[model samples]
Target: MGQKIIRFSDLTGTHVENDDDLVRIVVRQHPDLEDGPVEIEALGGELTAVEELALDLVTIELHRPGADEPETVVLEAEAFDRLASATPMAEVLRGAKKVACPIPSQTAVPAGAKERVNYASLEHAGRPHKGRTTDAEKQLVRQHLDRINERLAAEGVRTIDLGNAEHVVRYGLEALARERGVTLG
Candidate 1:
C-alpha cells in the first residue's frame, strides 16, 4: 500500500513567439502535497486544436498543508506534452484537472477618458526641431493644429485636416496629446 511519489521539480523550457513549434513548460513539486490530487497529459500532439495556445504553456504548483500559497496548475501545451510523457508520474498526476487562474483587474478610466497617445511620438512632434522648417515653425504648427481642433470639438472626434499642413500637425498633436493626458516628451 504505497504509491505516492510526486516528484516533478523545476524543469523549465520556453520558445514561444509566433509559435516556433511551441514549447513552454514550468514544473515544481518536490515535497509539498497537501490535498494531493493533480493530473495532466498531452504527449506531443492532439491538444484539442491549440487549446488556447496550449494553455499558454503550463505552470503547475501544489503545496497545500496550512498553505499560504501554492496550488496552481496551468498546462495546455498538449497538457504539457502529456505531463512530459508520463510513465508513472502518479498516473498523469492522478488524472489532472483543476484549473482556474484568472485574477487581473485594474480598469478605471472614465473621468474625461482618453489616454493612449503615441502616434509615433506625435510624428516626431511634427518634425523640425532645429532640423529646419521655419516661419516661426509654420506658425507654431498652425497653433498646434488649432489646439487639436479644439479638443476634437470637445471629444466628439472628427476634425483633423488642416489641408495637410505637416499631416495636420502630426495627427492633430496626436489627438491633442491623447485627449489631454498630455505628455508629448
Candidate 2:
C-alpha cells in the first residue's frame, strides 16, 4: 500500500473532523506557492473532506490527537479520502488563490486528472497477457524478447523460457524458437 501525499494548496477549506491534532500553522516557502513564509493559522482543527489531492510538493499529515499511534500512518488513496474531510470541490474552487499548474511537458498532468495506463499498473499488472494476440504483436515481442523479459520480471510476471513449448505457442514465438535453433512442439 502506497501512501499518497496531500499538499496544502491542493485542499480547499481544510476543516477535518475529530482533528485536534492536524497541524494548525504551516509555513510554506515554496517559490511557486508564495513569495515568502505564509503563516496559515487558525483553521480550527476539523477533518475537511478532501476536495482535491496532489503529490510530491508538500504534504500535510492528518492525525487524530492523542491516539497513541505512530508518528504518521501511511495510507492508500481511498483510505486517505475516507479518513479526510474537506470543503466540497465547488467550495474549494470558489475564488481560490494559487492553483498549481503542471510544468509544460508531455508527461505533466494536472491535479485531480487521471493518467492513462495507471489503471493497468494498479489493477491489471502482473496478470498473464490477455485478449487476442496479433501476428505483428508476436513479432514485436520476438524482436524485443530480452527487454520484454526484463520488463516482465520488473512487473512480477513470469519470464518466457525458450525451452517451454507452451510459452512459444502462447506468445506465437516459433520464429524466435527457430532463431534459437529450438525445436517447437
Candidate 3:
C-alpha cells in the first residue's frame, strides 16, 4: 500500500500562488479529478506558526495518527523538560502511525487498494472540512480499549491514561473506568 508519483512537472514561479491555485492546476492538468480524489501538492509554501518573545503558555496539536482528529496536548514545563531529555523520537514515539488517507485518491490501481495518497501529501492542497469522529466510531474504539491499552503498554508506549484529562475526554474515561471497576483522577 504505497503511492507512486506518475508524473512530475514544474510550474512557473508566478503560477500556483496558493492551495486554491494548486487545486486549480491539478484539475486543469488532469481532467479526471471529478472521477476521483486526485492527489495534489504545492511545494515552497511558507511555514506559519506563532513564536512569542516571552512565552508563558505552550500547546501542541498532535495528530497521533489513528483515524481520530488530532488532539491538542497542552505541555507543562516539566512535561516539556522530560520530553526534551528523552531518547530519540524514533524510539520514543512508537505509538504514532501512518494510516490510510481520507481522500479517495484517483489511482490507476483497482478499487479497494490502500495508500494512493496520504495526509501529508494532501495537507497543503487543503483537506475537506470534516469534523471529529462520529459517536459510532467512538463506541467501536471504546469496546477495544482494553486490548488496545494492553498492546500499547507492551510496546512500552504509555497506555491511555484515565488520569490525563485529554485521554478522559477522548475516550470517555470516567464511564469506562466505572464500567471496569477502575478509578480516575
Candidate 4:
C-alpha cells in the first residue's frame, strides 16, 4: 500500500494508492463530532507518467458524512504530490485548530456504573443452597476465611470471625462486594 500525507488549509487526511490504480483518502474527524471519520476513494483513473515521474490530476470519489452518494473530486497533480510526500498527516492537522461539534452534557452515570450495579444486585439476590456440607466443603470454607483474614490483616483492616462455614463464605462474598464499592442491600 502506497500512502501520502495530505494536509490542506481546511482539511487533513491520508491518501493511499490501492490495487487496480485506485486511490483512497481517509480523514479523521474532530473528537467532538462523534459522527465518525470520512473516506474517499478514486473510482477510475490511470496515473499519467512522464518519463519516470507520475502526474497527479487524479479523479477521486468522496464519501462525506450524511451524503446521499459518493461525489467525484479532482485533485491537482501538485496536491497529489504533497499528499504523497513524507510529511506526517497528524502533525499537519495539529498545526491548525480543529473546529468540532459541541459535545452534549452527560446526564447519566458513567458507562461502567450500570454493569457494577447489575452485578451487585445479582450478588445480593442469589444465595448458595444450604445442602449438607461435607468435610471437604468445610475445609474449603476454612481456607477461604484464612485467605480473607490474611488480606484484611495486610490492609490493616478488621478481620471477621464466623463460627460456621456458611456464615464465613457469605461474609467473604459481602467483603468482596464492598471492596469493589458495590453496596449489597
Q: Considering every candidate listed, which one attains the maximal lDDT?
A: 2
Using all chains and alpha carbons, the TM-scores for the candidates as numbered come to: 0.16, 0.30, 0.29, 0.17
- Residue range 62-97, candidate 2, lDDT tens digits: 445542222333445454444435755345547468
Model 2 poorest ten-residue lDDT run:
118-127
Instruction: Report the C-alpha displacement of residue 67, candidate 4, in angstroms.
Output: 0.3
Candidate 3 clash figure, as a count:
0
Off by over 4 Å in 2: 1-127
Candidate 4's residue-wise lDDT over 1-185, tens digit each? 99966432212223434444454546563433323367755423322332347444667656666543345667775675477455664466577576575566654567677421221121211123333333233333434545645655666655544543345455344443455465533
Which residue runs does candidate 3 get wrong by more than 4 Å? Answer: 1-137
TM-score of 1: 0.16
lDDT of each: 0.44, 0.52, 0.48, 0.45
lDDT of 1 by residue, 12-57 (tens): 2222223333334333333332222344332233333666553356
Off by over 4 Å in 1: 1-61, 64-67, 77-90, 93-185
Can you write out model 3's per-residue Cα lDDT over 133-162, one digit (the tens) per residue? 433334444556666667666666666665
Over 4 Å off, model 4: 1-56, 84-185
RMSD to truth, every model: 23.7, 23.3, 19.3, 24.7
Model 1 scores worst on lDDT over the 10 consecutive residues at 8-17
* Model 1 residue 160 lDDT score: 53
How far out, in Å, is residue 158 in model 2? 0.6
